[model samples]
Target chain A: MAYFDYLPHLVLFTIGTLIGLEISYKWHSEPFVKKKIEPVPLILALIGGGLMIFYAPLGLLFIGFVIGMRPGYGIYESVIGILFALILWVTL
Target chain B: MYYPVNFNLIYILLEIITAFIFGGLLLGLHRKVMARIQGRPGPPIVQHLLHTFKFYIKELSIPNTSSMPLYVAIVLAMDAVWILALIVGPILGGSFLIIIMCYAVHKVAEHGIGLASGSPYTKLGSTRAVLSATAEMPLIAVPALVFFKTDTLLLDGIINYQIVNGSLFTQLPLVALAMFVLVLSKTPYSPFGIVWGKDIVSGYKTEHFGVIRGVMMMGEILAFFALLWCFITIFFGGIITAPLAYMVAMTGITVILAFICALTPMVAPYHAVMIQWIFAILAVVNVLLI
Candidate 1:
């Protein structure tokens, strides 16, 4: 029952995050990688954040923080992901 | 449901004109402050206006290095979206609606411009822009949730909510923190300015010049007004009968926020990321409790 309460948010967060991760991964792996830092994880985080907006803004934000823990891209990505998540939660 | 015209052509024209003046002033003020922080008197507040005008009449430099038509088309499309977002503000029920549309359009337009330019700086801007957009998504959402539950997405809804349930800071202190973080990140100040700032040296706008760049600036200011209007509508009043009270209160708050953006040296991107998580946690806890 508790899980059901959070089901929509979680599903949206996961779907968005997964999409974000894949997009970020692809985006970073492109020839553009040599030109810039990795964007895959951050992109994943954004997708996750946006999805979370329609459900529980807070839940998505929490999920965003967790997904932000992926290694190698540094704090900027995590910060951006968290920020994006929060923005969607607050305003959307 | 019947909808009232909160914003219309007259209102939009007024808002756009105000945005132009206000954005120039803010940019100039920001520049001056940044210069003062670095020990110099920046250009006059009206300087941005002159810069913008110069860009308007300047020859549209069609770089043979790229497809001009596609580039122009993209910029136009982006500008149109942003304009639509801005005009919706006075037409919609309240400030939150304006903020959501404005931010959404701003992000899209920024990304479009970035891709269209295809320069290194522009690419960096585009990348940072995506990163910035990714960061702001959640921050914008949380506040809307509070409004949603109260059965209003307009400025009036927020004020009424405040009048009945008290300010958000009272009902949801944690979410308020999240809101602040969102404001900082979206505004791209010192700590959250990884994608913008002097380090990027023009960031996304680096490759742009003349009218293409001018249009982008116009969009940026419109977005800024949208942001300011949202802030006021949520925290203060949208279209208050007591205009003086609304102006005084909003001006005071806006000034404080502006000062914070100017005086504080930016934190590293790493620190910003850490702070984001902290605030996000707080916001979630607040929401769960609610």
Candidate 2:
């Protein structure tokens, strides 16, 4: 199931968030036709990521979300999402 | 004699629908009450809900200059992110951080949305959205004040702490007041609603019409509801467990928000930012000193 251990939170910071920001920056800055992204992958990423939130470590799901979010909308959202989560951990 | 084991699906679906409808109704109620306060008759409380459905049925189009992928994706992102917020929030009792993150995301997404449209109004709307967001940075103290008192950022932890210690708000009144400013910033026609100010012609969504608009409408409703739910549950404690009690409390807050929006005229954009910053800073200072 879901774990709230420091390892997962750290994974969320170093990998999950970085991947999301990178994908978003690339998606928006590059030409849309260069990648020929389809809605199906985006949709699947959403479905999988959402399901994972309930069943897996949240960090993994967010990383998948960033990868699928090539359109760049969730970039800022995902980044802030991790930050808020970190706020609690840092205090601990 | 027994409940089913697959209640998760039912609960998830129910919460999403409940949040959407309640969020829409709250907006409608706010409009009606605000109109009465301003000495004018208002539309029925279902008007906002009706408007959203209407947007879905109309013709949808994309601008020639728009960033095609982003223009399309932003609407979906708006709806998806909020739905995730709904699940991670009231449905599963996830951390308050996830809920707050979703709220913060909505603001930034608005900035991206405006930029994608290639319309001057949306671009300007995006600019203001960013400014207003930064201006409220001091609201961060609300959480800090909360963490200081409850020693936890998880909603469950906070709620449990409140169960034993009483409402954290009793000792953090200034932080609560600062949060009301945040609540004001999101409501339509609010003094702090600079991003969607009249001069901007619907601000970031000016170019987003038809089905896209409908999705965004649902997203907005969902976000509003989730924010309210989290705000109430976190500060007021277990009142959420009682449906009637939660409804009454939420209605009261909505009415207060509507009155404030109705009575206050929209300020100049920069002035709006300055005022929010001032209040946020005052609240932050209060939290620090305490």
Candidate 3:
């Protein structure tokens, strides 16, 4: 039941991303480049990230936060994230 | 063609109307804020409606430099996408991510139109618009993370979470703050108001006037309400328990936030960067703590 809750959101996110990508490509492409087109990578990134959120369900928020913080990962970031991860891991 | 009786077309139409009205209200508030900052009495709220309504019917004069069909197409697309976002909200029962996607779509559409114009000012505006949008991308992601942690991505779910947990501010205080900043920046509020700020030749609106401008104005209002709706839904909770009360509370908060926009000193781009850094740090800590 809990997993089912996210299924709809995941589907909608994917569809939305695709629509956005198609619109972007349609608007951005010039005449000469019309014949040669490929899948939009930015849209793909969002779709993949969204899918990860759907299946695993847990740790993604923290993971996304961590990934977002990137190479400058600070003490506060590590400590707070680990602590919360432990809390959810133990509780949920 | 019926899955359930959950969908109400009339209600959805009303929601779209409300979004536009709210947008017009923001324009009024914006004028008053600017007036106070500059030490003068600006026009009334109805000023925007009156001006735009008059402009809406006026003849549109296209410069010889203009590409009429492309220009009109872009304007229509921007308007349609914004209104579509409003309509889609209730139809989808206000799916949280879809709301965000609606916003992203609107932004992208605006960028396309701005870039297509080929005017130097419009080009500058489009660049600023894209840069500001780029800055917001990550900030916006923080809320979605909060949604994931709470295990509720629907507007109704987030609202219920607040009603159940007693105020979202208590749990994800950091995220709540970040979202407030996101709202101001994404909406291009003062200080972070680079897109259509006073000093920037109205950014993308530099060349725009008459009905095209009117349609863009309409789109702006609809877009504003959409962002506000998402902000209220995620952080404050959605229509939980008493829908009417929640709506009123959301309106009050939005008004207060608007006032805050009026009063705060416009921060420079570097300042916006520093503020975003602070917000990013807080979001990082928040993710771990949750």
Instruction: Judging by TM-score against the true structure, name the best candidate.
Output: 2
- DockQ for every prediction shown: 0.01, 0.01, 0.01
After TM-score superposition, the amount by which residue B219's alpha carbon in candidate 1 deviates from its true location, in angstroms, is 1.1
Per-residue alpha-carbon lDDT of candidate 1 for residues B10-92, written as tens digits (9 for 90 to 100): 65565456555555545544554555455554444345555776789887776655556767776776667656665555335
DockQ of 2: 0.01
C-alpha displacement of B68 in model 1, angstroms?
3.7
How many clashing pairs does model 2 include? 0
Scored against the native two-chain complex, candidate 1 gets a DockQ of 0.01
lDDT of 2 by residue, B29-101 (tens): 7987898788764655556876898998999999999999999897788888899998887666767777677
Reference-based lDDT, each prediction:
0.58, 0.72, 0.59
Whose TM-score is higher: candidate 1's or candidate 3's? 3
For model 3, residues B1-290, the per-residue Cα lDDT tens digits are 22245547665565566555545655555665556565654544344555667778977766556666777778778778777766654345456676677667766766766676767777777777777777677776765677666787766666677777776766777887787777777554556777666666777777788888888778777776666666666666633334344445555655666577767876766566677767867876897887
Candidate 2's displacement at residue B219, Å, is 0.6
Q: Which fraction of the native contacts appears in each prediction?
A: 0.00, 0.00, 0.00
lDDT of 1 at B109: 62
Q: Chain A structural similarity (TM-score) per candidate?
A: 0.44, 0.38, 0.32
